[model samples]
Target: MDDFDMLGAPQGSAGNGIGADEDPAAAFLAQQESEIAGIENDEGFSILDSGEVPSSLIQDPDDANSRKQEVEWKEKAKLELEEWHTRQNEQLEKTKVNNRAAEEAMVSELDENSPGTEWERVARLCDFNPKSSKQAKDVSRMRSVLISLKQAPLVR
Candidate 1:
């Protein structure tokens, strides 16, 4: 008996009688042509898909406009950064000027009220021009407090 597959088909021969050694491309082409020749008059088929081109497939090999735009955007970004730096420097200079003025005022104030001169400044701050009877009484009380403090001896 001839050799046969489990399905009773002859061994080394496909069900179509094509041998394994036969060129698959030629066999496939012959099968397709036979199928097409066997076709009777019938309605054609139509297909529909989402129709969107995938990003990977939608590539331009030479897109100079995009590169030009990128270069322009970079230049504008750099200019904006430079302007920000200039503004920051101006703000820093203004702050430094303000700080220097404040320090000078504080130094002059300290110099004017330093050591023995502090008592004169304190006396001027305490002096009051009394107009009413109540004001005069308050001033009198202040003078007594000052005199008592002045008479007190300093402990070594």
Candidate 2:
């Protein structure tokens, strides 16, 4: 009358009640064991093994040429780095000198005690009104003088 009773065991046989088809856990374990066995016997598994470089390619312990080349490259790199540093230091010194000269030129153009002769002459040209009249005329005159100086091209 029950579902288990429909599939009867052999007559007079003492069955373990739980059949092989009904046990999913045992079937899974058997499948896993078969897969593990297959993997263990596989020929491609040797490819997973680590390979080392041949001894011939490695630097010879007694060879001087390899050592000499290494030392030469290191010396070359050191010399190039030193030259770069020297050039940077020279550039920095040149910049400092140029900045110092510019500062000196600006200082010489200014008069602490009294206005310079050029300033007084330019001021007189525009009736001493530096902001409006004098500045405009002075700017034009200064531009002309700068142009002429450039045209003449100082022997630097």
Cα RMSD of all models vs. native, in order, equals 22.0, 17.0
lDDT of each: 0.69, 0.65
User: How would you encode candidate 2's per-residue C-alpha lDDT over 1-156 as one tens digit per residue?
Assistant: 534575675334237665545666888899999999999998642433457454554556667888899999999999999999999999999999999999997677564435234434343344323355643536666655545554454443
TM-score of each: 0.36, 0.34
RMSD of 1: 22.0
TM value for model 2: 0.34
Residue 91, candidate 1: how far off, in angstroms?
1.1
lDDT of 2 at 30: 94
Question: Candidate 1: where are CA atoms >4 Å away?
Answer: 1-62, 114-156
| Worst lDDT 10-window in candidate 1 | 40-49
Error of 2 at 117 (Å): 7.2
Error of 1 at 65 (Å): 2.6
Clash totals in order: 0, 0
